[model samples]
Target: MKHFIQQVLYALIASMLLLTACTKSTPIGSELIDQDQVELKFRDDFKIIAKSINVDSVKTYGPQENEQLNSYLCGRYEDPVFGKVEASIFTQLALEGAMLPDFITKEGTVILDSVILSLVYDSTKVYGDELALPQKISIHTMFEALDRADTYYSNQSFGYSPNPIGEKTFFPRVRDSL
Candidate 1:
């Protein structure tokens, strides 16, 4: 009985660690990935990551409103001759908490009059700046400054109104190249 109890405890601990480890970005390998795999993983993982974001309120922007996302098609070039340059083009908005590193970035914090979290995960099934996405993607909200009865947002001019950036679509090496 004691041995069985020990095994159960060990399993619980291992499962907890595994769950925590997966909350961050997905692991990528240099091996070539087929477009189908990219599409499947990108779609599935994106949904999962979006479900991870925690926000007081959410309002999805672009696409459904007969609009195109102002995504950024950035490329990384580090030649012994050419210098570093990065560019951002059309992109869309995402939900809170599920912000990823590669594709998406830290736009700013969002506030709301009430804590509405159900819609925080609905920003999925959409593409990022690029026309296509890569295989295996994820996002993390990381840090946040949430407060009720106060709706103070950093960049309220355009995006992040009711949505937070969970995942983004961008070049893998864009950040490093620049």
Candidate 2:
């Protein structure tokens, strides 16, 4: 019986080695194909409209009318033809759910470590030479709670501290990967 078990184990190991050796090492499309011989067809269908109109006055539009339009940050840009344009963003943070399982409570007084705010910029939406120019961003804390029932607009104003909580000066870098 001992000899039979040893023979079976050896046969199984040999089979596994043979299967692994037979497997392909490289992917199916590793070889390059000639692009000149391949004929690719492409088509683009779009329309562009250009019109000149006087823009003396403008009104603010709220989220109630257009639910899709919303901004959480504001920026200012100056163009040679368009002059100076200013924008502001307001946001509120909320807790998603209950405390995590690993959350621990200390017996004595607990001290705060540090608070961090991270902002991610969308590369595709960026305009102008952001790489060459450095931007100074100021973050202010809100004085009052934001109203969930009321619709917010770009031109609307909210109560916030006159002094900023923190400020940072940095150049924008496009993120390529996660």
Candidate 3:
């Protein structure tokens, strides 16, 4: 009986030790993490000056098939330093995947109410310091579709209506949220 009691006491002690040994693993480098430190060095050894460059001829390239543009720009600006700059863009609109619902289609003579064109501006993609100044902009309808087969360049011209569809004069205000 004494031997059995000793055996049972040993089994209990072994089980208690096994239970105590089992513990959750701690992640490495998790204890008391230090904040990141950054150091910057500045040197003013040489004087910087702007130089004027005269160009006899300048060449421009067009957009390729592999390249993709996010926005279509159409505007003309006259800068004292950069001279006159003009840009025009063409886009294709299609409702391929977006189909009208059956309920909307069932209703006869669906009259259009209003159309609104919203343009989101990217602050980081600015070129000149004319954002604060109010500029006149005119929008016209394209007469022809942009050819997918041909490459388009900055100097290339597209057919557009002579009359302006809309015109606005406002200062560009860059915002974080649209």
Candidate 4:
């Protein structure tokens, strides 16, 4: 009985030790990025066409509705407190004939770089008189390929939208200025 007890005690200690070793380290401020800067970059310059929205399961994405619908299903929505989301993305590119198995971007920021971002857009009909293109957004794009450890931007997946003012024909995310 004592031998069985000792074995159990040893197992418990081993388990505890393993748990301690497995604990992951907390991330530092390095990963944090400024969303305002990205927005400002577009607000200031405002000219990058979005090519596509690559996701984990390319198979699931469809063209019938496009990125807007995709964003809605994923988890983006307009909340009184959070503001507009999912609606924020305005794509000049069509969802039809899009390639599969492409991780074009999983997470992104508003700042400048290879990728660009634009939270503001025209709320008119799907094909209304508007820019009709997604701003090139910077994903967790590295400042330097050599410094793979270093990152410039961070993403939270979805954005918030403010309450709508009128029964306007415009969609939600299309902000007036940008």
Candidate 5:
């Protein structure tokens, strides 16, 4: 019957498709290359001649032509190409909101317990070896105030108290969360 022939044809096509779908085929061009015969080698040593140069003072405060920096660098490391490099940071501390009237009124009665500081690390911009010795960081109160109108530079120096108000020494954890 015509109906029986149509059903048979449908079954035949379905079985054919099922057979192809269940079958696993090898990757294309995988048989063309032999893994044992292929060898990979690299050279790590090379004659590199370089010299360190004095760089000009970098803008450390405010915005440069409407551009502002999101982060700053502070550390000492030895580079293979640039040799030894050291960096320091200078920033102004500020309080949030317009003012605290309650704290101002009870300033003398308020007892100071402790002060805390938090810093976020930029892992992607890390330089030098992470396995190197731990770095020491000290925070001191500046003798002079940083003016927003004045442009600060990397070569610029500021006077601070000889004693450190806070200090911390830790290893650089670039990949891990600090």
Candidate 6:
């Protein structure tokens, strides 16, 4: 019985070795992929004139109406080649259910302690030095309301308070969860 079991194991091992040894010299997915489609052609004789152009404006608002946004950037980064660049965020706050006025009327005088602003940070989207100095952020209330139907651009001006309601300076830990 012992000799029979040993022989069976040896046969199984030899079978596996034989199966693995029969490998084609061609690429693994060569059968599935077309040789013509995956061909690479290089051209270096032509002069390449690479010049960066300034973008005048970009549509930043309205995901449901005009534009869609996966994420919003609000920070300042100084690139050695591109100089200094800053991004600002202008967003409209919305209630979960009833209107603010209606809620106030029904629930009497509501004592609001604080307004918490939560943001999910994307590490991959961050450019420049991630370990640079702490970025200063100022939050101000907008005088004009943002309409969902209207499209807002990067260069478009929205009336906001001169004085900031809240201000915070902190180092951005991009990899860390909020």
Q: Rank the candidates by TM-score, best first.
A: 6, 5, 2, 3, 1, 4
Please provide, for model 5 over 2-108, each residue's C-alpha lDDT reduced to its tens digit, 9 standing for 90 to 100.
99999999999999999989667765776788977655699989887768777787767764646457788888877676777888887767555558546654446
lDDT string, candidate 2, 17-100, tens digits: 999888667545545656556555787786766554545433343445565343244467887765677777666664555553
Off by over 4 Å in 2: 1-73, 97-114, 176-178
- Measured on C-alpha atoms, candidate 5 has an lDDT of 0.77
Looking at candidate 3, the ten consecutive residues that score lowest on lDDT are: 54-63
Tens-digit lDDT track for model 4 on 36-98?
443322355667654434343322223344422322221233446546555222123223454
Candidate 2 at residue 159, lDDT? 84
The residue pairs found clashing in candidate 6 are none
Query: Where does candidate 1 stray beyond 4 Å?
Result: 1-69, 86-138, 145-178
lDDT of 1 at 35: 45
For candidate 6, what is the TM-score? 0.59
Better-scoring candidate (TM-score), 2 or 4: 2
- Residue-level lDDT tens digits of model 1 in 1-178: 9999999999999999999888657548524776457654234444332223335432223324333233323334333444553332222234555565544437665443343222111223323443243422223333443433234332223222333434454343322321
Clashes of 2: 0
lDDT score for candidate 6 against the true structure: 0.77
lDDT of 2 at 50: 55
Between candidates 2 and 5, which one is better according to lDDT?
5
In candidate 4, which residue ranges exceed 4 Å CA deviation? 1-60, 63-113, 122-174
**Which parts of model 3 have CA positions greater than 4 angstroms off?**
1-65, 71-77, 96-114, 128-132, 148-150, 176-178
Q: Give TM per candidate.
A: 0.16, 0.50, 0.47, 0.16, 0.59, 0.59
Clashes of each: 18, 0, 1, 19, 0, 0
Query: Model 6 segments beyond 4 Å from truth?
Result: 1-55, 63-66, 97-113
lDDT of candidate 3 at residue 145, scale 0 to 100: 77
